[model samples]
Target: MLRYQVVESFLSINGEGKRAGQLAVFLRFAGCNLKCSYCDTMWANQPDVAYTWMTKEEIYEIVRQSGAKNVTITGGEPLLQKGMKELLAFLAEDESLTIEIETNGSVDLTPYLSISDRVVMTMDYKLPGSGMEDRMNLSNLKKLRTVDTVKFVSGSREDLIRAVQIMEEYTLRGRCACYLSPVFGRIEPVEMVEFMKERQLTGVNLQIQMHKVIWDPEMKGV
Candidate 1:
């Protein structure tokens, strides 16, 4: 009888991270713990937003219908949902499916550790531009593995400085794959690349939001 507050679920090519251009089923959960300045999905956190309350079986059926081998569970902070453990547990049954969750890195990841081997956590380390960087649970960085990814959405040169500091502090490159992406239309990818080159920053990749390029930047759902 457990149900998840789902804002929307659709099949789309992953627009970011290491999986960019990969077809996957995305489940956008409702609600969030922080309000970032550039959040495109603020509507997902609004109390009055329209959403479907779906049970595990219902969610599984949707994924089955998508016929995608990869599933991305994103949010307004998916960890805020009560039934995520159950939903993840259900999804884990499909050994052939690769499940990934995108979190704001402010929530405790321990709850999902049991299935760590099966689930990949794309933890976004919020930067100064987000205005919610203080809320980041630094300990979560220790939970990462090579299978997971840690990302920084840089909105300015200052933000990349913070990312570099953290990257060195945690030796994140050796811990897991680290990615640096310019905030859509705010910071340019070329600028980030130059910065990395000048500093001889190693082990961090420059990524772009491929979905925004393939479709109208303003378009939602693939």
Candidate 2:
């Protein structure tokens, strides 16, 4: 049986991405390859973290019962898990669902691209503040489509500047949904807006984690 190390699963509004503010089923998987300085889900990334082993059928049933059309497969770093493509393929069988895979910048996305037309990607572009910038797979940027998203979680002005440079270099604005999100308390939204205006970074959206605002920042399971 194919099983996944699931840290948590819940129904909630997508706090980020193009589907932000819309209700979605979140499947948070366990483990990650890189440690970001601003990672809020560090508790779920620990080597010995408590997790439930779930088959793809079990996971699909949870989403089916949630009555949500949008599904977000997030993680400490979702792509690191084995059988991820198979799991995604299973989920994709439900044509009515919109599956969004949230991946840290390190992993290669090419392997999962053919899984389904309904599967979209929300990849991160870790900045210097994350301390995992060098681990980013730059090639993944080219793979993003208009339906996909590239999120830049900025903690400092330097990070914001680097984000703009990368966006320009990759011509990301027209290629996909580019988002600049503040690292919770590190940088303010107004500050990010100002930076965007100053740089004339047109077409990029500034997103705030709505779940953190609706509930406690540390709260789990929505």
Candidate 3:
């Protein structure tokens, strides 16, 4: 009875964040609570976007067929789905599988706390460039553990400054893995690295979108 709206499910390397370059099965869900200007997956954000309804068992079957031990449950915002907690609980039973939940950091994560050990929450903390920073659930930052990551997408020097401020304010680096990634085409990855070095911001990593570099930036379903 619990069916989820799915935009697509395919095998692809994680393009960004800490899991970049890892082969994983991506389960892209439909719908989101916030809209960002530079969202690459805008197709999945539309309220009327056509999607297939799949239950947790159906999704798990696809993952099993993919032959990938790792799975990333991503979306326009996965937490918005009513049965996401149930889906995650089902996936967590596979002790050999590594699951990652890519969230927009605007929804409550408390429901998934019990399975935190099995699922890594790669939370995106929207900056000014995204226009959705105000919508971020800052409380989620406190819930992160070493296995999880808090990411900040910077498009300009000002964005980087704000990210650093939030990092210190939250003591994020000490709390969990912190990453600073540049918004593609807006800020150069080297620029972000230089800024991090100048600030001597230890424990924070600078990452680029690896999948974009490996394939055409516009290609889908890789």
Candidate 4:
């Protein structure tokens, strides 16, 4: 039996992504490959972080009972988990649930792409501020489908500029949904908007973490 190191599981509205503000069952797996400077879930990635080892069936039960149609498999980097493909395959058996994977761009997405069309992805392109930019797998950019989303979390003006360059270089605007999000307190939303307007970054959406606005930013399982 393949067991997952699950840090936490809860029912909360997706704070970001294409399904932002919609109710979802979040399954946050433990551990990560890259350490971003502004990582809000550092607690979940610590070496001593407490976690429950769960099988695919157990995880499915949690999602099934949540009564949420949308399911988010987030992390400290969800794709790093062993047997993730099996877990996703098991989850996809439930036709009613809309599944989404929130992956840090370092992981190769090609393996997961064939799992199921139901398994849409919301991948991050770690910006310069994250300190994990070089670890990103650039090949993943071409693998994104129309239903997928590529998110750039910017913490500074330089990061924002690099994000635009990557967007244009990959022609991400029309290939998939492109989003620009401010790293919680690092940069102002208006600043990002101004940059977007100046660049005429059409088709790119600017988003803030809605859950942070609704509840305390540091609050867990929200």
Candidate 5:
């Protein structure tokens, strides 16, 4: 049986991207390659990752338990798991489920492209302040489609500058749906809007954590 760090499994609203507030089953896998300063899921960082190893049949039972029509494979970095392909292949048997993955954009995601017709990939594009900018593969940005959304968590005006530069260089503002999110309570959403207006950026949206409003900002799940 393949081992996987099943960090957390629960039902909740997506809270981000184009599908905000949609009910879904979130399978937060454990382990990450990038150590971004503002990572909300930093509790996943460990000296030795811990996980619940399960066979594909066992995995199906868990999703079957969730009673959710949508499923999101998130991480510490779900792509880090080699068995992720197997998981997706198994899940694809459920014809009614809409599967999506939230990736940090540091990995080659080609293998996952075939899993679902509605794979809403949400890419977290690390900025200068995230301390992992160099790890980003520029080619992936070009491959990202309109169905995919890119999220940028801005911590400062300098971070915004770097984000805008990357957007322009790749024509990201026009190519796909882009999201500008202020680190919760750090940068102001109003400030983000003004900056976007000043730059005349198109396809850029301001995203807020919707679950934060319904539940406590510190609350883990619904």
Candidate 6:
């Protein structure tokens, strides 16, 4: 089995995106293909941190002991891992468990779509301020199933405008929910909500980092 840079394994509330506040065991994989400027998880992208490499069996044992009915496959970029698929398959043995994955909205997830029926994909679409617009997989947006969702984190009026325009331009599937999240402290959630209302942007919803607002924003592992 290939080695995995296991960042942290702890039982915590799912802080953002879907399944928020649900009991979850997060697998924060280390390493990302794109470097977004607003990325709060920039720590995971670094290469120097100490990591533990474990096989699928070892990971399952840890997850079982955690007593978490939900699992969120997060990262720097969990999909970047070579055996991520195999690991997901192994976890699928637990029928009642809900699996979720957070991606940068740049990788090809078609491969995992078939096996991960219960997996809710929280895909982050890069806005202009993110400095990674070119890295986006536009095709991946169209390929997303109803279970998959697209998210755009806006830092300014320009960023929000672009996000709405792109969704309309691509004729993004109506089945997918369009998530518009602010840059936390950088952008006001109320202002963002008002903008969406004034523009009458259909298929749009607001998202805030609940854990950040309720707990220590600087903390990690829930």
Query: Pick by TM-score: which candidate is best?
Result: 4
Structural similarity to truth (TM-score) of each candidate:
0.97, 0.98, 0.97, 0.98, 0.92, 0.94
> Per-residue alpha-carbon lDDT of model 2 for 1-222, expressed as tens digits?
778999999988998888889999999999999899999999999999999999999999999999999999998998888899999998999999999999997899998888776899999999999999999999999888778889999999999999999998999999899999999999899999999999998899999999899999999898
lDDT of each: 0.90, 0.92, 0.88, 0.94, 0.81, 0.84
Query: With candidate 5 superimposed using the best TM-score fit, by how many Å does residue 173's alpha carbon deviate from the native?
Result: 3.2
Candidate 1 ranges with C-alpha deviation above 4 Å = none
Candidate numbers, best lDDT first, in rank order = 4, 2, 1, 3, 6, 5
User: Model 4 off-target regions past 4 Å?
Assistant: none
- lDDT for 34 in candidate 1 is 95
Tens-place lDDT per residue, model 6, 161-201, is 99988888876638676789889778888889889899987
Clashes of each: 0, 0, 0, 0, 0, 0
Candidate 1: tens digits of C-alpha lDDT, residues 31-135: 999999888888789989889999999999999999998999998999899978888988999998889999999999988978747788899999999999999
Better of 2 and 5 by lDDT: 2
Per the 3 Å backbone cut-off, how many clashing residue pairs does candidate 2 have?
0
Candidate 4: residue pairs that collide: none
Q: Report per-prediction Cα RMSD to one decimal.
A: 1.0, 0.9, 1.0, 0.7, 1.8, 1.4
Give the per-residue lDDT digits (tens) of candidate 5, residues 93-186. Answer: 8888777888999998787776666766788999988888899977888877767878888988888888888888888876678998888777
Best by lDDT: 4
Write down the RMSD of candidate 1 (Cα, Å).
1.0
Clashing pairs in 5: none
Q: After superposition, how far is residue 136 of candidate 1 from its true place, in Å?
A: 0.6
What's the lDDT for candidate 2? 0.92
> On TM-score, who's better, 5 or 6?
6
Residue 39 deviation, candidate 4, in Å? Answer: 0.3
Candidate 2 has a TM-score of 0.98
